[model samples]
Target: MSEIWFRTGEATVFASEGQATDAMPEVVIGSVKGPVGTAFASMLGQTVGHTRMFILRDCNQQVRPAAIMTSKATITNSAYVGLLGGVVQAALADAIVDAVANGVIPKDIVNDIAMIVTVWLDPRTAKDENLDQKELYKNNYEAMTTALTRAMNQEPTIDELIANRKTIRHYSLEGLDIE
Candidate 1:
């Protein structure tokens, strides 16, 4: 039974010592934001849909969570997201009739997708259960204001937000909301 393992380069692994145990890199898992999923889905829809439109076969799938985690860290590209969101919105606008007619997406699936996308865009709408009136109103107001602002102002891009954002003397250092 060997207690240590040597490497060609200067790196060595010792089984008896705890160095090898702690040598493994720490992997922090995170979620993916922005329109990566939408893009992936669109591509999948085009390619996979052509081959297996609605087959019930279980295909082996491998997802890279690390890739998703890294992408989520820097997914502040609102312009890219807006592009994908526009596509999703456009598809959703007529998905019901068109998908059903074309047999691309099922009606039930379309409805579910609409609900999911609606939830992703405005989470408040997805809450079916009742809550405190004040909190409910707050969430509703936030969601409505966000939607209205985006619609009226053309959904400011992340670059625009970064460029336009300015800090007040007192608020800037304190990280407080100026407006």
Candidate 2:
């Protein structure tokens, strides 16, 4: 493969359907020309909870940037695994297809580029039977679209970051005393 450009982006979609279904995906978009690609190729090995797998548009096709997705959250229940591998995976894969079609990812480099997205999925999602499956799909779909779009566009420019630094804090730190 010939050397090509690289871009990275991260975005979170949360507090939508429910806390259990929030999606935070950090995407690395680049060719096998660098470290990110190396990481992508190597992520197939599974640990206990994080089962790395290629996101497929169907049984035969993997979404381009040739995306790979895995959850960081430790999953203890079989039900959680079902949701993570089922609806959530389908949602994220669809978003990736849209990204390529929408020009958020260059169509030409679909073969050359690869993506490895670190996804954060709260494992409690399976405990509640009444949780809306459609909402969960929508939440993750939005997250992947936002992340890929921002990656290709290089969003939140340095100026934006500096301007928001004082007002915007990590959500977990919302009630903290730090300044």
Candidate 3:
């Protein structure tokens, strides 16, 4: 089966394969159900080979679908099973979109997602509270490369540059032309 690593809080839709019908019936969030366990059985029923789904739970008052994992048999020519997994994943992602759009899921889930993205993009900040106490800095790959190139200016002497240099964590655009 195809391995779909979906964004958090997103759901996908899946349809049956090779039914040879006009209207393909779609099942949304077949991986995880609101009432719980219903989606599990449905996914198992849909699996042509082997599949596994994961449900992340918060002790009380919160039990939602977190992640889904599906596997295909090694000895079987089950390439179509990958297509099936993709369908299911898409349905799950759509379900997430619908839930968020309809406000079925709490508003904080959006904020949680944003926070997660922020943490991933800025791991240095996320690592420690004190880390942000210094002058806050965010450097992208291009920006960092530009800064390095500028730092290595055509100096008269390496010793002179070394003597004048300061060990600074942050980058500045002011000193690039100084030779």
Q: In lDDT terms, which candidate is top?
A: 2
Q: What is the TM-score of each candidate against the true structure?
A: 0.21, 0.90, 0.26
The global C-alpha lDDT for each of the candidates, from Candidate 1 onward, is 0.26, 0.81, 0.29
Best by TM-score: 2
Put the candidates in TM-score order, highest first: 2, 3, 1
- Tell me the tens digit of each residue's lDDT in model 3 across 1-179: 11211222211111123221111121122112232234334443434434443321222312233333343232133333333233323433343344445564443443222101000022222233343221221122122222212222322246865776774222444667543
Candidate 1 off by > 4 Å: 1-131, 157-163, 168-179
Give the higher-lDDT candidate: 1 or 2.
2
Candidate scoring better on TM-score of 2 and 3: 2
Error of 1 at 151 (Å): 4.2
Where does candidate 1 have its weakest 10-residue lDDT segment?
A: 3-12
Off by over 4 Å in 2: 1-5, 17-19
* Clashing residue pairs in candidate 2 (N, C-alpha, C atoms within 3 angstroms): none
Error of 2 at 59 (Å): 2.0
- Residue-by-residue lDDT tens digits, candidate 2, 17-50: 4357788888888887677788888887888877
